[model samples]
Target: MLFVNSDKIKSKPLPSLSENTFLRYFSFAALYVAQGIPEGLLWYAIPAWLAMNGKSPAEIGSYVAVVGIPWSLKIINAPIMDRFTYLSMGRRRPWVLFGQLGLILSFLSMSLIADPLNNMSALMILGFIVSFFEVSQDIAVDGMAIDILPVDQQARANGLMWGSKTLGISASVAAGSWIMSHYGYFYAIVSFSLVISVIILVPLLLRERPGEKLLPWTNGEASKAAEKIQLHSWKGIFKSLYKVFFLPVSFIMGVAAFSYSFGRGLIDTVLPVFTVQELGWADTDYSQIFATANLISGILGMIIGGFLIDYFGKVRMISIYMSLLILLACAMSFLKSFWQNDIFVTGFIICFYILLTFTNIAIFASAMQLCWKRISITQFTLYMAISNLGLAAGAALLGPLKDLFNWEYVILCYIVFAVVMLVAIRFINFEKHQKRVEDLEIKHPDINIG
Candidate 1:
C-alpha cells in the first residue's frame, strides 16, 4: 500500500541504508523475505503436510492455535522495544539482529524432531518458539521502516516488501514440501534455515543510520535524534497511546481489520484440509498449487496493487475488496457441484488468493493512515496484534465448527465476518482522528507528532 525511501536522510561518508535508495529497499525487502520463510514452513507447509499425513482438523487447529498465539500476544514487545534500545547501533537494528538470529536457531531446532506426526506436542512448542522470534523481528523491522521511510516512498516500498514476502513463502512452501517428501523434514528445515541465515548479512553489511554502529564492538555514539526522542519512562508512551488509540476512528479501524482477518484466517485453515481430504488433491499437489497462486498474487501485488490503492482511496477500495470476498464465499458455499470440477476449485483458490493480496494492500494503507505517529510504533503494533488475534480466533474456531457444521455452513460464516468488517469500517471517521492529532501536533510544534 505504501513504499518507503528517504530523500531527507543524506548519504554519509561510508553511507547507510537510509541514504541509499537501492540498498534501503533491498534490505527491507530481503528482511521481509526472511520473515516469510519460517512463516511458510511453520504456518502453511507444516500444517498442510500434517493434514496430508491424516491429521484431523481439530489436531491441526490446535497446532496453528498454539503457534499463532505468540503473534497476537506481541503487543507487549512494542512498548519494550520503544523504551529500550542500543541507540549507538540504531534504535531498532539490535532487536532486528537479535530476532533474526533467534529465527535461525529456532528453525534449526525444528530438525531435531525424529518423528513429527508422533511428536505433535513438541512441534507445537517449537512452532510457538519460531513464531515468537518471528514477531519480534517483524515488529522491529516495521518500526525501523516507519522511522526510516518518507511518506513519498511508502507505497512502493510496501508493495515490494509484501511481494518479496509472498515470493519467499511461495518458494519455501514449494521447496519445503518437495524436500520433506523426498529428502525428509530434517533437510527441508535445514535448507530454509540456511536461506534465512543469509539474511543476517544485510544488517551486518549496511547501517540503518549514518554514524550508528554496524556491530556492538564498533565505535559509534547515539545520534542526537535518537537521544532527544528516547523515552525516559513508560508513562509517557502509555499516556500518548491511550489518547490516540481510543479515538473512534482508530478503534473502528482496528475492529475492521480484525473482522476482515478473521474471514481470511478461516479460509487459510480450511483450504489445505478441504483440498486434500474432500477435493482429493495430494498434499504436494495442494502445496504446489497454493505456492503457484501466491507466486502470481505476489507479482500482481507488487506491479499494481499499491498504485491502485493510492489512486482509488483506501476506504472505498477496502469496501469493494470485502464485497468481493463476500461474493466469493457465497459462491464456494452454495455451489456444491462446482467442487467436483477440478478446474473450478483450482480457479477458486487462485482467484481468492489474488483478491486477498490486493485487499491486504488496501487494509495496510488504511492502518498506516490511521496511525497517530506520536507513539506510532506501539499504535501500529496494537492494530496488527488485534488483526492477528482475530486470525487466531478464526483458526481456533475451525476445528470446533467443522465438528458441528457442514462444509457449506463453515464457508458461509465468511459472510458474517465480511458483514462485520463492513459495518465496523462504516463508523470510522478518518478526518476526525486526523483533526485531533493535528491539535496535538500544534501543542508540540517541536516534535514530529505525525
Candidate 2:
C-alpha cells in the first residue's frame, strides 16, 4: 500500500530500534562509530600531522579551538531539531541522515584544498562546516536514545556507544595518519567518508517506532508514541525547555560538565606538541600511541565501564574517578623527568584515558537522567554545549599558558579546573531535579513530558 500527503510521503514502517534491546545498542554504537571516524581524522590525525610538519602550538591550538565552534552552538541547533521534523520518518532519523550527508559533502570538499598547510584559514572554515553537521547528528541521536532506552540500559548502552566511538577514533587516527603521511590528507578524508557513507544505512534502515514511516517517500504515519511527545509549536518547546533547564540541579550539572572538560581540553591541546616537539617522539609515534591507548580503553569500556556505572552508582563512580585523575595530574606534573621516558609517557596517557572513560560514562549517564523528555534535546545538548565550550576555552588557552609558564605549572592548572567539577558534583541532587520534573509533569500532564 502507498500513501501520499499534500506534500510528503513515507514508506511502510520497519521495526524500531526501541523495539529490540540489541538493536538499540547496535544502532547507537554503529552511528557512534560513524561519528568517530571523521572525528579522529579531523581532531587527531590532521592536527598531529600539522604538528609533525612544524606548525606552531599556537597555530594548532587556535585552529582546533575555532573548529569546535559548531559543537558549542548545539544549544541553538537543539531547539530547531526538537521542534521541526517529519515525525512520520522518526524524530531524529531525518536529522541524522541530513547531518551525515552534509558531513560527506564537506569531507569531499577537502580534496579541493590544493595545499592544506598553506590554507589554514580555509581548513578552519571547512572544519567548522563539518562540525556543524557533526553536532546535528550528535544531538538528534542523543535525544532519540533518551526517548527509547530504558533507564537500566542507559549506562550499558553508553558504554557501547563510547567504546564504538573510541574504536573508530583509533582506526581512523592510526589509518588516517598512515594515509596522510604516505599519500595526502585528501585520501585520508575521502576514505573516511566512504565509511561514513556505509554507516548512513544503519539509521536509514532502523526506525524509531513501529508503524512510523521508514522514508519520506514511503507510506507511513507518525507513530502514536512519537505523536504523544511531539511538541505542537515552537513556543511550547521553548516553554518546556525553560521550565526544566532553570532548575537548580540542572544548572549545577552544566557547571560541572563545563569545568571538567576545561582540564581535559588543556591536556588534549598540550599532548601532540608536547610529545612530538618537547619529547622527541615522531608524529606517527604519537598517533600510534594514541590509537593504542584508545584501543585498550575502548575494549575496557565495552567490557566493564557501563556495568560498573550501573552497579556502583553514576555520581559516586565519577567522584572516585575524578580523585584519581587529579592525583595523576599531580604526579605527571612533578615527574618531569618521566616526560622523556617513552614507556612512562605512554602509560600516563593510557591510564588517563582509562580513568576518564569510566567517569565520562557516569557523567553522561547522570546528565541523561536529568532531562525532561519533552525538552531532552535542548537540556542534554546544553550540558554537552557547556562542556565543549570549556574544552574550547582550554584548548585556546594552551598556547598562551605554555608561553607564560613551565610545563609543570601548566599541568598543575588542570587540577584546579578539575577540582571545580568535584565541587559541582558534590552539590548536584539528581533526586531533587527528578522530583521537580515529576511534579511538573503531573501539573502539565497534557504535554507528555514524561
Candidate 3:
C-alpha cells in the first residue's frame, strides 16, 4: 500500500505569492505562452497560409471570425469557473490542466487530418474547439492571477504575462511559417503539440498557498473541509454577475473594452491579405515582418507600458496611448498613399505595433483593476470578451467593407473607431470602482478576495 506523511506536509507553510518571484512570474508567463501559441497559429500563421493557398480575403476573414467566436463568448465559461473549482487540486490549476490537455489533443487531431483545406468545414470546427479550450484556459489563468498577486504587483504581472504571450506568438509564427514552408501542415501541427506539451508542466507542478484545501489524492481531510465552505450558489452568482455588469464604473469600463480595439480589428484582418497580395510578399516574409517584428516590439511595449500604467495611472496612460494610435493610423494611411518604399512600410508597421502593444497592456491592466475578488474570473473575462467581440465584429465586417469601400475609406473607419473609443474612456471612473471593490472585500472578509 502507498503511504505518505500527511502530518509533515500539513505542518509545512505553503509558499506565499510574494515569497518567490521566479516561481510566480515564470508560472504566469508559461501559462500565457501556452495561451498565445494557438492564437498565433490560428490568428496569424494560418491566415497567411490560407491566403497563400488561394483562399479569398473574404474566406480568410470569415474563417477567423467564426473561429474567434469562442473567445468573444468566453464570458459564458468565466461564470462556471468562478462558481466551481477543484480547491484541493488548486482552485484554478485543474481547469488549466484540462484546457492544456484539450489543446494538445486538438492539435494532435489536426495533425491527423490529411487534407485540411479540402475539408474546410472540418478545419473550422477544429479551430473552434481549439479556441474554446484556449479561452477556457485563459479564464482560469486570469482568475489565478487575481487571486495570487497583490494589488501593487498586478500591473507588473500583467506585463510579464502579456510579454510572454507576445513572445510565444513570435516563436509560433516564425516556427510555424518556416515549418509550413519547408515540410507541410502536418509537421506544423506536430510542432505545436510538442511545444504545448512542455508548457503543461508549469501548472501541474504549482501548489496552492498553504492552509488551502487539497484534492483527495493529496489529502482527504483538506478536501472535505474545502467542500463545506460554500462559495457557489445560483442566487449569489447571479447577483455578483448583475452587479459587475450593471455597476456604473464597470459598465463604462465594459464599453471601453468593446470600443478600444474596434479599429485595430478592421486593420488586422485586411493587413495580412494586403501584405501578401498587394505587397507581393511570401508567407515567410510577411510572418517575419509582421509576426516576428511586431511581437518583439510588443514585448517591449508591454514591459514599458505596464510600468507606465503603474506609475502614471491607467487612465492617463491609456489616453496618451490611444491618442497616439489615432495619429499613427492617419499617418499610416498617408504613407500608403505617398511612400510605397518597403523600408518605410516596415518601419511604420513596427512603430504601429509598439504603440498598439502599449495601448493593449494599459487597457488590460485597467480591466484587472476593475475586477471584484469574489468573482474575478467572471468579471475580468466579461471585459476581455467584450474586447474580443469588438475585434471580431470588425474582422467579420472587413471582408464586406473591403468589397464595398476602398483602402483609404477603411483607414478612415479605423480613425472613427479610435475617436469613439476615446469618448468611451471618459465615462470610466477607475478610482470610484476601485473604492467600491475595496468596500466589497471588507464586507466579505471570509471570501478569498485576492
Which model scores highest in lDDT?
A: 2
Total clashing pairs in model 2: 5
For every candidate, C-alpha RMSD to the true structure in Å = 6.9, 5.5, 5.1
Residues 1-450, candidate 2: write the lDDT tens digits.
Answer: 466575665544446787899889999998899888878887888999999899999999988998887866788999888888898988778888898888888888865788989999999999888888887888888898888888788899899989998888888988999999999888888888888888888888888888777878887788877777778777778778778888899888888999999888999888888888888899879877876777888889888999998897878888999999999999999999888788888998999988888888888888898898777888898788788888888999899998899888998889998899998898888788889998877787766442
Q: Which wins on lDDT, candidate 1 or candidate 3?
A: 1
**Which pairs of residues have clashing backbones in candidate 3?**
88-214, 88-215
For candidate 2, the TM-score is: 0.83
- Model 2 residue 415 CA deviation in Å: 3.2
- lDDT per residue as tens, model 1, 101-207: 99999999988988989999999999999999999998888877777776545666677789989888888877898998888889999999999899998887777
> In candidate 2, which residue pairs clash?
9-216, 10-218, 10-219, 11-218, 11-219
| Clashes in predicted model 1 | 9
Cα lDDT of candidate 3 equals: 0.76
lDDT of 3 by residue, 1-450 (tens): 388877656555446333566788788889899998999899888888988899989888988987888876776788788778767676676788889899999988878877887777878889888888998888888887876676666777788888898888878877998898789999998999999999887776556454443434665223343343325665566666676667788888887777776777877887777777777777667656776566676678656757877888777877887888888778877666554577877776777778778778777777777777667788788787788888888888788887888776766678788887788787778678878767665675544322
C-alpha TM-scores of all predictions:
0.80, 0.83, 0.80
